[model samples]
Target: MYAIIQKFHSGWAYIALLVLVIAVVNAILGMASKKEFTAKDRKIALFGLIVTHIQLLIGLVLYFVSPLGLASLGQMSDKSLRLTSLEHPFVVIIAIILITIGWSKHKKLTTDESKFKTFSIFYGLGLVLILSRLPWSLWF
Candidate 1:
């Protein structure tokens, strides 16, 4: 089960990240081109939101099952354990929340430029946050 979930999280992460990048880029390009918001734009953003949410759920479940997760909590002396147990998860959760807020705010936006700008700032920041805390050594 651990192997299965670990694999799922590992693979799904790529999809989630890719979609997020696409959405951010699309929003930026749309704003730059001054194009009216379209259904396809909404779908692109929705796809990113959905994939990110899925990844978060998978990660939450894996946190409980992985030894490096809950089991390593309070072991702050060990850098790697500290990261996987607390820092990585905490930062990623914050990033996801930012992305969620960005999506919600985009819906309330009245202008095409405003919507894209919101996504560009918020989603872009979220992606950066997630990238910042990833446990590169363990992941590698």
Candidate 2:
């Protein structure tokens, strides 16, 4: 169960990150070009939100079940264990929150530029945070 969940979490991250990157890049492009935010743009961002949320759910389950997750929380002397047990999950949660905020805030916005700007800033920050804490060693 732990191995399956861990694998799923690892695999789903690629899709989640890809969608998020697309959303951020699209938002940035829209803002720069002063393009009107259309239904397509909204859908793109929505897809990003949905994918990330799914990834987060998988990650949460893995965090509880995996030996390297909650079980290793007190073993912070080892950098790899510290990342999986503490830093990775912590930062990823915050990143997800930022992404969620960007989604919510964009809906309340009236101007297209404002919507794009909000997504660019928030999603971009979330992406950065997630990337920074990712277990690169385990990935490769």
Candidate 3:
């Protein structure tokens, strides 16, 4: 069960990251070109949100079940164990919250530019945070 969940988490990370990157790039382009926020644009953002949320759920479950996750929390002196057990999960959760907030804020905005800007800043920041803390050795 742990291996299955771990593999799912690893595989899903690729899709989640890719969708997030696409959404961020799309928002940046929209903001730069001063384009109206169409349904397609909204869909792109929504897809990104959905994938990320799914990834988060999977990650949460994995954290509880995997030995390298919560089980290794006390091994703080070991950099790799500390990262997988604590820092990675914590940072990813914060990033997801930021992405969620960006999505919510975009909905309340009245202007196309405001929506694009909101997504750009929030999603972009979230992406950066995720990238910074990702366990590259494990993933690769």
Highest lDDT: give the candidate number. Answer: 3
Sorted on lDDT, highest at the top, how do the candidates line up?
Answer: 3, 2, 1
State the lDDT at 38 in candidate 1.
Answer: 86
RMSD of 1: 1.0
Runs in model 2 with CA error above 4 Å? none
lDDT of 1 by residue, 50-83 (tens): 9989999999999999998998898999999999
TM-score of each: 0.95, 0.98, 0.99
Worst 10 residues of 1 by lDDT: 131-140
lDDT for model 2 comes to 0.95
Per-residue alpha-carbon lDDT of model 3 for 15-84, expressed as tens digits?
9999999999999999999999999999999999999999999999999999999889999999999999
lDDT of 2 by residue, 1-140 (tens): 88889888889999999999999999999999999999999999999999999999998899999899999999999999999999999999999999999999999999999999999999999999999999999999
Poorly placed runs, candidate 3 (over 4 Å): none
TM-score of 2: 0.98
Q: In model 2, how many backbone clashes occur?
A: 0
